[model samples]
Target: MSLVIGLTGGIASGKSTVVELLKKKNAVVVDADWIARQVVEPGTFAYKRIVREFGTQVVGADRKLDRTQLGRLIFGDESKRRQLNRITHPWIIFYMIRDCVMSVLMGRPFIVLDVPLLFETRRLLWLCTVTVVVVCDRDQQIDRLVRRNHLSREEALQRIDSQMPLQEKAAMAHFVLDNSGSLLALEEQVENLWQQLQCIRKQRLRYYKLFGTICFGILVGIPLCRSIATHL
Candidate 1:
């Protein structure tokens, strides 16, 4: 059986970095962001839905959904963000599940689903055998978002604040990849997890077999004992 590993974290929490490391292992990496974008490509149902709701302002001269335009409008507005989520989240989840199932059915030992918003919508959690949450210090997350995305500190914080806290996410994760340190250190941790995961799976299978054997022994022994006692 294949293992589906759901990878998630807040924006700029080094989730992408962790995904890069995972891909180095040759695991099938299904990035939800990419799937989301795919579902919104010009002729997609999601694209049609978004355009119908948001109108032409959100579309460019190329007649495509101007993602940056929509981002500017919705990133700071709660109602708008939720509206956009309503329009696109369902389709995105559909593509994510499709790709994940395809990867697993192809006989890959593991599939890494790099879903940045795994917890945000709570749609794909059921597909995961194990969920790995990549995290960094809150300060680092804020700083990276502000610098990389060119958002103000307030904007960065609001984006971060809109989701589950990193502390809470860590506790809830089946595995946590701390990305506050150097790339080498982060990779070391991932490698360790990979090895330990293999060992844990092996142990689980062995335990299952052992349990089956013990149950069978007891089942047979009980009947034998009863028969011998009756004969005596």
Candidate 2:
């Protein structure tokens, strides 16, 4: 069985850097953001549902989702945001699980599920053998968002505030990758994490094999022991 690692972080907290390092280590990385975009593509069930619920106003002239428009609508309104999550989160979870299962069946040693909302979703956390959260100071996160996403300070703060706080997520994680310092420091953390995950995967596989062998021995010994008693 493959070990499933749930990777998550607050927006702009350097989760992508950890993901890149995991990829370099040949981990099967299933990105939830990529799945989110694919599931909402034109002609998808999510696309149809979104259009029906939010109307064509959220659809562009090209008949595709106007993500910016949808974002504007949902950002301030909790009800609309919940409605959108209701439509898409299920499909996202379905695809994420399917991909992870496929990886496991293919005999992948481990998989990294890069989900932005892994902790917030609750159910996704149960799927992981280990949960890793990338963390940075709130000011650092806000600055990174402003620089990377080009959002205004207020907008960046709003986006950050929408999710579970970084401290809370870090508390819940089995492993925390701190990105508060240099890239080299972050890379070192990832290297150590990769080594730990490899060790964990091996240990889990060893335990499973031992357990299976014991069960098989018990099954075979039970019949032989009964036969010997009968002969006696």
lDDT digits (tens) for residues 84-181 of candidate 1: 88888888888888888887788787788888778766788899888899889889999999999898898888788877887777787899989899
Candidate 1 lDDT trough over 10 residues, lowest sum:
196-205
Task: List, in order, the clash count of every candidate structure.
Answer: 0, 0
Runs of candidate 1 with Cα error greater than 4 angstroms are 204-232
RMSD (CA, Å), candidate 1 to true, equals 3.9
Worst 10 residues of 2 by lDDT: 68-77
Q: What's the TM-score of every candidate structure? A: 0.85, 0.96
Evaluate all candidate structures by whole-model CA lDDT and list the values in order. Answer: 0.85, 0.92
CA error at residue 133 for candidate 1, angstroms: 0.9
